[model samples]
Target: VWSREEEVRHGTYRPQSSAQLKATLGKDGKISAWRTDYVQSGDAEGETSFIYAIPATSRRHFSYQSNQRDGPWRSVNSTQIGFYNESFIDELAQAAGEDPYQFRRKHLAADSRHLKVLDTVAKRAGWGTPLPEGVGRGIAIVESFGTIVAEVIEATVREDGSPQVLKAWAVVDCGTTVNPLNAEAQIAGGMVMGLSSAIGEAITIDKGAVVQSNFNDYNILKLAGAPAVIDVHFIESGAKMGGIGEPGVPPASPALANALFAATGKRIRTLPLMTQAKA
Candidate 1:
């Protein structure tokens, strides 16, 4: 399961009247710049977590969305911002003796929303097409925050013994998309962010403090290690407004892990696949 708090800012600009503008301008006929800063801050505080049963047959995805101030926010937003707990993937895969990607796809296919995302990503990623000798592809999807997200990752091992994320194809359905450009950016950004976690990032705890204090230890994927391409597609069902905040996280880790399994015979059970690949 996952939990988060988000604060968003919106600003509006209004031009002052001619008299006010003239009063502010200097006698030299050049207007001096006067600036006033205003802040409108809103806080969204809530907890969302999920649990899955063994055999991976039973899955529960739930979340709650409430503002610091009083008033009902739409259920659509609430559903889109809930928790996604993936702890059951490993246990279920073990129980079925099946690949995690296959298991997840099988389960997700039962839901219409998830199925649409899977279909779109598969088509975009060329799921069944052949690849070079060392290349492999893996795919996974999750339903969170009223959105269904699916991702396909291609990975390979380089000569220096490092795993590389070559490309990522992502599909998301957040009901009716408000802005296509922003939506595309959101998905692409999420994939890159997830790539960081998959390849070379971690936060460790020791004794009672965070042991990895700086970027030296808390690494992120750089331009050299970043995926060459991330393709994002959105499904417009004309249903309702869904989520855009965090639906991008769940798919990348597992997809990258599966891709690593293809590049190497090893199945990655933990995150930061680069660490294990190097070892």
Candidate 2:
């Protein structure tokens, strides 16, 4: 990940690119048998650690090389990571000659809770249904801050190299949801922001200041570009309570990316779709 730059004094330097990451995913599409290498690119701020949520019979490993800066921030960055990781997973599924939704469902069998959301979202999005050429449906699932969110997006790729999202469906399991209205709004807001970033939000550094200062330069999802329909469903699984704020964001970006790949047969490794693959 590349960090932003800021200056405290003229002709002086302050660096933020303090951490670098490399990861490898193994076959079978599970988090098992994978490795991640992280290096600290600057002065040491604190110690680094690795956390894994492996059930029995799992084999996932990670390594961290730290000089130090600060721990990675959540919210925004988590969405980016989800976009990168889940998109790659979809590619793997396609390479294996399997439907992306079914591929993920097969791998997530261990966690019935996760499967619940995945199955529900896919059903709501009409998974396995036929679509016109150049149109595709994509599904992605993420657990953020203990809340599990699964999203499915329907999108079409136009000849002009632009992608238009048609509809979005989400199934969130945050345990017993206290307030249904608030949870739905939270999830919908995350989906909008996530789609906006995936479609047209790019940031670059020049000298030491941000090149795009305002919305005019940093384009966002306009009314016409936003999804025509969005459905958010909550599952009262009676599990442990979880946060609803950020969980919805991660799946939004990845689901959109996967849908684009399905439509165009091209993978997008970078944000702001136009950067790598056109349309």
Candidate 3:
């Protein structure tokens, strides 16, 4: 789950969602087939939330609508789906006794842009390298609005059992990056927001009235809690134009979740991870 947004957007905020993704592996531990069944319900009428996953066939996207319009925040639905699906992927890898990084590699197509981005991040972040005690690294890949992005985060367990994010690495294959500097800023900002909400951010309700009225009782990822370093790398797949702003937000939280499980051996099943401290 995630921090639920207020019902103020022209575009629906991402609804609380549930999904089950099942994959079958061959004898060599390669994914021979996979399928995802997604569900979204219990929302109000006229709610038109949507999520775009990996297309199974060649396709052309003719229209281009950015997700930054006044009331239509980008990637709300994608972020929810990424968190659930990617976290499930990590859990599957763990259950199968396979390295998460290597497991994803075996499933991706050799020539796809998604694979390239995933490979880029893993190699640059030294995916297979050893880490000091109590250190854990996690990776996640997500595709939305014509972009394929991969992220790797390294975290450590604090003395009190809380997780401390030290660094993050992101690789983007967004078909084309119009402006390198702007793209970098977009991804970095998205990651910061993603981590911010994942750590601690929520809007409670009591008797149909809002509970968190201001920042005083609410949560935010202050500077003191942010990752010290975030590195962004881009790959121009040259297939078609894609939105840079929306794609970056989906990967950060899931990568952090996987990282936490690795650092503490506890699977995360809720949001505002502080609520499940040391998880």
Which candidate number maximizes lDDT?
3
49-162 in candidate 3: lDDT tens per residue?
A: 122223241211122232323223457567766787688778878877899988777667778787789889999898989988778899999887778889999987677665
Question: What 10-residue stretch in candidate 3 is worst by lDDT?
Answer: 43-52
Better of 1 and 2 by lDDT: 2
Model 1, range 97-178, lDDT digits (tens) per residue?
Answer: 6655555555442646666777789889988789988887877666666677878899888777677889999899889888
lDDT of 2 by residue, 1-279 (tens): 322222211222212221222333456544443333222233222221112232323222233443223344335345644654577668767766788877676666556888888889988888988998878788888776778888999988766777788999999999989999999999998898788877887655577455765566767888888889999999999999988877788788779888877877777766677544464
Question: How does candidate 1 score on lDDT?
Answer: 0.58
Model 1: lDDT of residue 274: 61
Query: Cα lDDT of all candidates, in order?
Result: 0.58, 0.69, 0.73
Question: Which is better, 1 or 2, measured by TM-score?
Answer: 2
**C-alpha TM-scores of all predictions:** 0.64, 0.77, 0.80
Deviating ranges (above 4 Å) for candidate 3 = 1-14, 21-26, 32-35, 41-73, 159-161, 275-279
Weakest ten-residue segment in model 2 by summed lDDT = 7-16
Sorting all predicted structures by TM-score, with the top scorer first, yields: 3, 2, 1
Off by over 4 Å in 2: 1-32, 38-76
C-alpha lDDT (0 to 100) for residue 151 of candidate 1: 85
